[model samples]
Target chain A: METLKINYKNLYFPPGGILMWIIIFLELITFGMALVVFAMYGSEEPEIFHQSRLQLNSTFGAINTVFLLTSGFFMANAVVEFKAKNVKKSSFYFKLTMLGGLLFLILKSVEYYHKIDSGITLETNTFFAFYWLLTGFHLIHVIMGLVILIWTNNGMMKKNSDTEVVDVEACAAFWHMCDLIWLLLFPVLYLIF
Target chain B: MKKTLLFNYGLLILLTISTAVISNFVAIKSLAIGLIMGLSALKFMLVSFEFMELKKANLFWKVSLIFVLFLIVLSVVFISN
Candidate 1:
């Protein structure tokens, strides 16, 4: 009888941890489903969708994209530095990541204020309904990511803290998930419509 | 690793600018939308593979991520058309 061997190196082990990846997948699916519904309605009311989309500031969306991507880059570096046992450098990168999250929230809030001032509300139309729901949900995720990053950073800052590498990696994974969600949202909301 | 990450970062920025230009300045609507979505997928891949370290992850995760992206993009494009 021949013995079968499993390739351990190629086997799937979720980055960060199993639970974190599960959460990531669930979030992605939720957003993806909402986007699909948005698209269906968009096709049904092309003119409305197009006009509503044009009212949005793509420039602001682009700027937010840059901010989130740069933040994600810094967060990734934080994980790398942590793995290399450079706790201070990792914490610095985490701070940068949080800054990026703050900037995104500020810009998004400004955009929302403009919409409200212009008399655009969730009840304004189908497009605006999605506009508020999708982006607002994502904003919540960003806030959560920032909180997690801060907690991870604080843990790292403590003297003789027993913060494990997995904890930091999990935070990084969550931050990157936020970036990924934004990547999907930006194009669907700001560009493609 | 650092050099590779830096290179990816530059690529992401370049892609972002290109997406903006294509979406805002391009006269052909279909072409612009197509390019924008394509660029978005590329950006997503870069972030997942590099920043998220999905490149080193299991085949199941990589495939699942790509599959979800495909579904979303396809649905949007299909509806728009």
Candidate 2:
């Protein structure tokens, strides 16, 4: 009888793991449903949607987009370094990624402040309501991603720790999903009507 | 790999800039919408395939992610129209 061999390395599941991917799918669907509802409401009140979009500071949205993308880039590099077993470099890159997240939070808070000062609250209108709900939910994800990245970085910095490669990859995957959600949100809320 | 990451970063920035310019300068509403959404999709793909390492993922994951994006974009475009 011939013995059968399984090639574990050739398994084609997503980075992180199957559980992470399942969570990612669910998150994406939730955001997608929110956005579809947003679009439907916009269609119902075209003029209001258009006017509300104009009130948004696209410049801020554009800056936040750059920050998130850059952070994502750093996170990607961190993962690559981790795969290469370069712990110090990976940790450094993860810190940079966290820096980007911090900047995004600061800028987003400023934008929110300006909106609130201008008397734009969630109850202001349907557009403002969606804006607050969608972006607020995403902000919570960013906070979670930052925390995960910090934990992963700490693990990487420790010598001979049991922090598996999958854990680091899972952190990166979650952070990238945050970026993905923002990419969709930016266009729908800031650019298009 | 470093070079690929750098290239992806540059491409993402370029796409971001182009989308902003198109949406701001283009007079035709449909044209602006089409260009902006198209660029957004392109950016989304770059991030997914590169930063998210979707390229190394299984067929099921890749298809699911892309399908979700397609549905969202289609829904937005349809309802807006």
Candidate 3:
């Protein structure tokens, strides 16, 4: 009975703690609903969606997917290293993770530049509107995630720092959420018309 | 554990590449989209379960997350139709 109670508590808390998990779920639901609506809009005008999707540069999208996923993997390793009390290795992995994120942002900026160059702003059309809005919101999340990762890494490296395991886990959880959101966005906005 | 994580990473990259190639090259539009979405779903499950450590969570969370996303992906399939 004692073990059961402890197990229940642990489960309730999760890796990044219960509050972070709640936020993750809320974010996921919000993105999921937006995607559903995006698909509904696509169904209404397949041609516009198809044409807009063609202009999207799927190669860029695919490369970004790789970037985010690779970062996510590095993040998982960082968490593991942290758990093992290997702060140096953990910090190294965190740096690699940030590099992945930086690569993603640079490439995304180029993609956005191309869109702007071609005069494809949010007001261009329905497809472009969703493209800019959904991905724009996601970009904000990625930026926020990078800030958290840097903070977490710096704190860990500081002597006598008070950074907790749960803090790192929370940062990682948030980072992976970006990956999850992009997973949906990539296919819906880029592949499926 | 690290080995397992590395394996999952490799698999995800391969799946991502294959899904992109298949969706782009396949002749049938609906078939291509369907296959791509299905593969996307698989990739989603892989990242959530392995990388996010959802596999270590309780049954409730593990099941809820998977089922919710699966349903959302299904809705996406129907929406694209």
The i-RMS of every model, in angstroms, reads 1.8, 2.0, 1.8
DockQ of each: 0.70, 0.70, 0.64
Candidate 3's displacement at residue B17, Å, is: 0.7
- After superposition, which runs of candidate 2 have C-alpha atoms over 4 Å from their true positions? A1-12
Native contacts retained per candidate?
A: 0.72, 0.80, 0.56
lDDT of 2 by residue, A21-59 (tens): 789889989999999999999999999999999999999
Candidate 2, residue A134: the lDDT equals 95
Q: Model 3, A1-193: lDDT tens per residue?
A: 0111223236677766678778888988998998998899899998988899999999999999999999999999998888778889999999999999999999999999999999999999999998999999999999999999999999999988787777888899999989988998899899988
lDDT of each: 0.88, 0.89, 0.88
lDDT of 3 at B77: 92
> How well does chain A score by TM in each candidate?
0.93, 0.94, 0.95
lDDT of 3 by residue, B14-80 (tens): 9999988898689888888788888888888888888888877778788888887888899999778
- Quick one: ranking by TM-score, best first? 3, 2, 1
| lDDT top scorer | 2
Q: In terms of DockQ, which candidate is strongest?
A: 2
Residue A174 Cα positional deviation in candidate 3, in Å, after optimal superposition: 0.6
**Model 2: TM-score for chain B:** 0.94
